[model samples]
Target: MNGGILHALLEFAFYYPLVMSLIWMSGGIIYFLRWERREPSRVRPRPLPDYPMVTLVVPCHNEGAQVRETIAHLASQQYPNFEIIAINDGSTDDTGAQLDQLMDQYPALRVIHMSSNQGKAMGLRAAALASRADFLVCGDGDALLDDYATHWMMMHMLESPRVAAVTGNPRIRNRSTLLGKLQVGEFSSIIGLIKRAQRVYGRIFTVSGVIACFRKSALHDVGYWNTDMVTEDIDVSWRLQMRHWEIRYEPNALCWILMPETVRGLWKQRLRWAQGGSEVLLRYTTRLFKWRQRRMWPVAFEYVMSLLWSYTMSVIILLWVLGCFMPLPPSLYVDTLLPQWHGVVLGAICLLQFLISLLVDRRYETRIGRNYYWMIWYPLVYWLLNTATSVVALPKAIMKRRGTRAIWVSPDRGLR
Candidate 1:
């Protein structure tokens, strides 16, 4: 009996990862098919008789070194009727002095100095209150926007009155290290593909906080930036969507931001994100399942299932690691193990899915002119890092009490 139980555990351990790999590969195939079917024509341009008033709100905390460059980038945006507002969230560094200098340099730039660190949610709320623009672009101090990014985003929102918010495509600004190369893959494969899926399915899970534009009216409707959750962006996106507001994904509107160059940094960043996602799920789980809001259930279901799935993967990996040293019973192995031919069939399907992902990423990266070599090791490096983070994050999220906040940790910005 003991040997039978051990064999059953070992079989579950070995095959579960393979099952997850198949599911991920299947998702990749679906994304590729969608990409192939998408229209190739450019988004039509619409003339605006009067450009809407735009406010670019940047939240800063201990970002003295990079805040000036971010301000300069915002100041240089080509939009004629936009104001740049930088909110200093009680920085203990020279961030205030740096902002003061920049404020003096550009009359259009405004700075709001907080006496002590109140977190990003408070800073964003304060900045929104200070601004008088119809549309607000919230950004981090380390993020740099493309010259035409605001123009493209605003045009999309203006043309489509129903679009309550726009999410920018965040690309790695510095890719000098292997970790950075892996992150490039992460953005293209995992993050980018998920965003495309969400769009196709008419349900976006979270808007990237690094750079996202929200209509002021929608902000008011949903109650701007709830401070209770660590991930205010995720919470707010769900809030807007629940209220029947449309969120659009603008892949061409680019924002350059630094990605973690080390495993430790990446782990911390994803931990915070995972925790925030859990908070959002808890806060909105009831609304997510209501009969009137049935359409939004799939989005919430995906997130919940993903969180549970990560925990399962961690357990399976742990079991597999232990199983390698132990002998398994013949009966259990015979029952659970796939036939050799079946294994070969599954392997071929996985290979085909991986190839499809590679081809799609390659085509997208080629148009953007990034190095193609980065795509080769992406499946190993990027996917493993994600799985590891999810394993760590999901547990912390569940065990930790609500109201545990994570302050903004700047990514490795040495190159920038």
Candidate 2:
């Protein structure tokens, strides 16, 4: 009986990732053909009679060194009618002093100093409160926006009044280390491709936190960012979209941001993301079941299935480790962890899918082509790391006590 059950679970554990890979790859190809092949509309001039006033909010917490560069990038935006608002959310460092100095340099710069660390969502809320503009472009303290990114993102709002939010394409800024190169490939091949696919499906997991634009009216409609959610970006995206407001993906609005170079940093970053997703699943179960809230069914169902897959993988890993002491029937060979024919074929499919995506996104990114060799080894790295994170994060998400603030640790910015 144990053997039969083990075999069933083993088959699922091995085949499930392959199945998901095929689905994502196929969806990505179709999206590329239908959408990416066409020329982007950002280049065409709208020539607005009056450029709408925009408030660019940079929410900070202990970002003393990095925040200055970020503000400089914001100040240099090509758009004519926008202002930069720097909110120092009680940084222990010289961040408040730095912002004060910057305000003197940039005539349009405004500073908001919070008395204490209130977290990102709170800082953004404070900025929104002070803002009189209808359009708000919020970027993280660590990211640098392209000069025309603001203009491109704002165009979506101008073209469509229904658009509540716009997510920018975040490129990795640090590529001085091996881990950085791996992430460059990961973002271009996995993150960017998946987002395009989800958009083609009329659903996106989140409007990226690193950089996104939100309409003031839409923010009010959805109640703005949630302070308690581990990932406020993911939470806000769902909230606004659930209210039938549009969330757009503007690939042209590129923002260069830093990524983790160390294994510990990468693990913590992904764990937070996984935990946030799990928390959203837990919090929205009742609301998702409402008769009128049917549009979110697919995203909700996908999360549930992913959770089940995570749990199953965890159990199998534990049992396998235990079997190292007390021998059991092998799922594949029982004696060896060698790559079987099925594994090889699935791996080849993964490679093929990656190559296709690379070709599709070749125009957008420059250096990723040389990093393709590292991508071949990413599956082994990803499977072990992602599975471990899921196991740890799922429980954390479930047991999280209410009213606990979602403060964050500093992310590793690679070997800069």
Candidate 3:
């Protein structure tokens, strides 16, 4: 009985990721052929009949270093009829002064200085309340919005009233370190592919927190951003979808954002992300059992299975470590730890997944292929890092006090 259970664990550990990779690949290919490839040019956003007034909300906390460049990029956007709103959420640095200086340079740029440090969710809510436009485009203070990104995202919003929000594509800008370089590929191969696949399947897991556009009406409908949620983006994505509002993935809406170059930064970022996801799952699990939420069943199931897979891998690792000190059964010792044909096949599939994603994404990101070599080793790195974080985050999610406001903190913006 013990051997049988161990075999099943090993099988799940090997095949679950393999199965998910294939699903993402097929769905991504289908989406490209059906929607993406049909577009005349991914480089340019299609011209619209009417340009709606859009307020670009930028919430900042100790981001003086990157704010100027971020605003500079937004000023160059191809989309017209838009205003810039920069919320200086109690920055200890000169972020307020910087925004004020930029306001003098750009007439349309508005600055809001909060007396105390408010979380991003509250900052966004405050921005939403103060916004003059019905349409709101929000991004990180450190992100460089592509010239055509606003136009691309707005096109989707204008196309249908049902589209409550449109998520932009985030491209990593800093690649000075090995960790940074791997993340470049990770975004294209793992994150980008997953978004495409999820979009094709009728629901996205979350929008890119770096850049996304939301309708003011929809924001009000869903109660704006949740102040207590660690990840406001993920929390809003679930709320909007649950209300029957559509959230779209717009690859043409590109934003250049920085990522963590150090191990500590990366671990912290992923831990928060994992915990946020777990919190959403726990919060919505009961609501999803109803007949009305049948579409969300697959997403919920996938998340649960991923959690189980992480625990299973943990068990395997624990047993392997124990085996180092004490004698173990021959069958268990030989079969559990070593990579056999299953590992070889899984590795091959991972490589294939990277190839397919890079090929599809190359037109939008011309230099993505340069990082392909780094991607070859991404599975090993990704598995260990993400699995560990997922395990650690689940308990944190469960124990977290509900309605507690999650404060904003200065994150590692990578090496300058």
Per-candidate count of clashing residue pairs (backbone under 3 Å): 0, 1, 0
Residue 173 in model 1: shift from native, Å?
0.9
Candidate 1 segments whose C-alpha is farther than 4 A from its true place: 1-49, 325-370, 403-406, 414-416
Candidate 3 lDDT, 1-416, residue by residue in tens? 77888889889999899999999999899889988998855556567989989999899999999999999998888887999999999999999999999998998899999999989999999999999999999999999998988899888888999999999889899999888889988888888898888999989889988999999999999899989889999999998998889998988788999999888999999999999999999898899998988877877888899999999999888878878888888655533565679888988998899999889889788778889888767877878899999999999999999999998878889975
lDDT tens digits, residue span 1-416, model 1:
85665555555534654655555555555645764336232333344666888999999988887888898889888778999899888888899899998888999999998887777888888988889898998888989987777876786688777889999778787788877766666676567666766776677889999989999889899888887677889988999999989887766567888877777777677777877887777777777667877768878876766665566545545555555666544432333233366456544554454455456655434543254455556545654566677667666666767666545555556344
Off by over 4 Å in 2: 40-50, 329-336
Report each candidate's C-alpha RMSD, comma-separated, in the order given: 4.5, 2.2, 1.3
Ranking of all predicted structures according to TM-score, beginning with the best and ending with the worst: 3, 2, 1
lDDT at position 78, candidate 1: 72
User: Which of the numbered candidates is closest to the native, going by highest lDDT?
Assistant: 3
Pairs that collide in candidate 2 are 330-334
Comparing candidate 2 with candidate 3, which one achieves the higher lDDT? Answer: 3
- Provide TM-scores for the models: 0.83, 0.94, 0.98
**lDDT by residue (tens digit), candidate 2, 263-286:** 988898999999999888888888
Better of 1 and 3 by TM-score: 3
What local lDDT score does residue 381 receive in model 2, on the 0 to 100 scale?
78
For model 3, what is the error of residue 262's alpha carbon versus the real structure, in angstroms, after optimal superposition?
A: 0.7
